[model samples]
Target: MLADALGQVPYFSAREVEALVAAWNKPITLRRGEYLVQHGQVERNLYFVKSGLLRIYYPTETEEICVGFAYAPNVVCSFPSFVHGTPSEYCIQALRQSELLGISKNDFAALLELLPNIARFWREELEKVLVGRIDREIDLLLAEPERRLERLLRRSPHIFQLVPKKYIASYLRMTPETLSRLR
Candidate 1:
């Protein structure tokens, strides 16, 4: 799965995959409801999801608001924390038993210096994340719930497969009942 994710990058070769696997060779596992990076913790690692599902959510005084999700073959981390050595704003929790590969910031930095292709790939991934966030913001700005649901369904119907209905509702900024009604 890691290889498949990396393989999507331009100029990412088998050699690059080997380098990535070697750098992130540490295996990690999480059962359902277990946190990968708890809120307020400094997240020093980048994670590659081999299998299972995770939700990134922001905790408030009353509730946890879903922000995003990660599933099989996906790379996920507290990006702000990983990049700036800051505390994470969200809790990354496994929604199902999850198998993952983790690499520390130091190791990833070394890999970036050692491999140019990996660096390019990382930049492109970051760009995509940025664009995705912008797109999501635009989606949320729409006043109608149906439009929001429609856009999400059009863009990432697979999210329905990765997470449960409640979290999906939260991610869409709607109640579970509302989501159901719309569906």
Candidate 2:
């Protein structure tokens, strides 16, 4: 899966792809409810999801606000923390049993030196994340729950296959009952 994802990068050559596969050498496993990242923790590794699901959220006194998710064949990381060496406010937790491969900051930095093309992949991924965050902001800004629900349905129908309805409701900034009624 890591090779396949690396292969998709337009700037990567076959050798660069193999180098990435080698760099992502740390194996990780999580049972349900395990935390990949927690508030105040600095995230230093980029993870490739080999299997199962993860929830990206922010914890608060009242609730955990569902913000995003990562699943099999996708990459997962606390972006700001990973990039800036700062502590993350968000938490990434396993929602089900999961397997992953991770590339540490040191390894990735070395790769950035060895393979300039890999930087392109990182930039593109960052761009996508920024765009998605902007779109999610717009979705949350909508006053009507129905509009938010419909927009998500149109934009990410496949998400229903990966995440539970409760998290979907939270992502839409609505109660599960409200989401149920809207559906």
Candidate 3:
């Protein structure tokens, strides 16, 4: 699984990947609706999903807005808090029964200490995620609701099928009624 995930990760050796996996605290299983990380909590761990989906959300004035999702072979966490040792403003929840390999901030730092190459990989991953977020923000600002929904579907078609329409509406910065009209 790690090999498949790292297929495009250059300079990563199989042995190094093994070492990284060995460093994880444990594999945890969560049921649907379970809170992986709660808002205002100090985020100290990163979860690598083995199977299932996780939703990253934040509370708006009156509702929860799902900002993103992580599926199998993806990593999910409130990265800023984990990296800075601060409380998270967002929450992550299991959207389905999930299995994850969890590594605490301390353990991950130790792994990076032992293998600086992994640190480089982590940094690169963060850059890619940030870029994607920026592109999404730009699209949302420039596009109409239907256009935005089309773009989102083009990028992540499965999300439309998996997540509820209400969450999707919030993510698209539209009201549920507007989303219904678009549909």
lDDT of each: 0.90, 0.91, 0.83
Cα shift from native, residue 58, model 2 (Å): 0.4
Q: Summarize candidate 1's per-residue lDDT along 64-128 as a digit string, tens digits.
A: 99999998888899888988998999899999999999999999999899999989888888899
Clashes of each: 0, 0, 0
- All candidates: TM-score: 0.95, 0.94, 0.87
Best-to-worst TM-score order: 1, 2, 3
lDDT of 2 by residue, 105-136 (tens): 99998988888788777778789988988988
Candidate 2: C-alpha RMSD after superposition = 1.3
lDDT of 1: 0.90
lDDT at 150, model 1: 96
Give the per-residue lDDT digits (tens) of candidate 3, residues 1-183. 644675557888886677777776478898999988888898888888888888889977888878888887888889778878888989999988988888887888888888878989888988999888987987679658888888887878888777778878988989999999988
Higher-ranked by lDDT: 1 or 2: 2
Candidate 2 wrongly placed segments (more than 4 Å): none
Q: Give the TM-score of candidate 2.
A: 0.94
Judged by whole-model lDDT over C-alpha atoms, candidate 3 comes out at 0.83
Q: Which residue pairs clash within candidate 1?
A: none
> lDDT of model 1 at residue 25?
76
Residue 39 of model 3, lDDT score: 89
The Cα RMSD of model 1 versus the native structure comes to 1.3
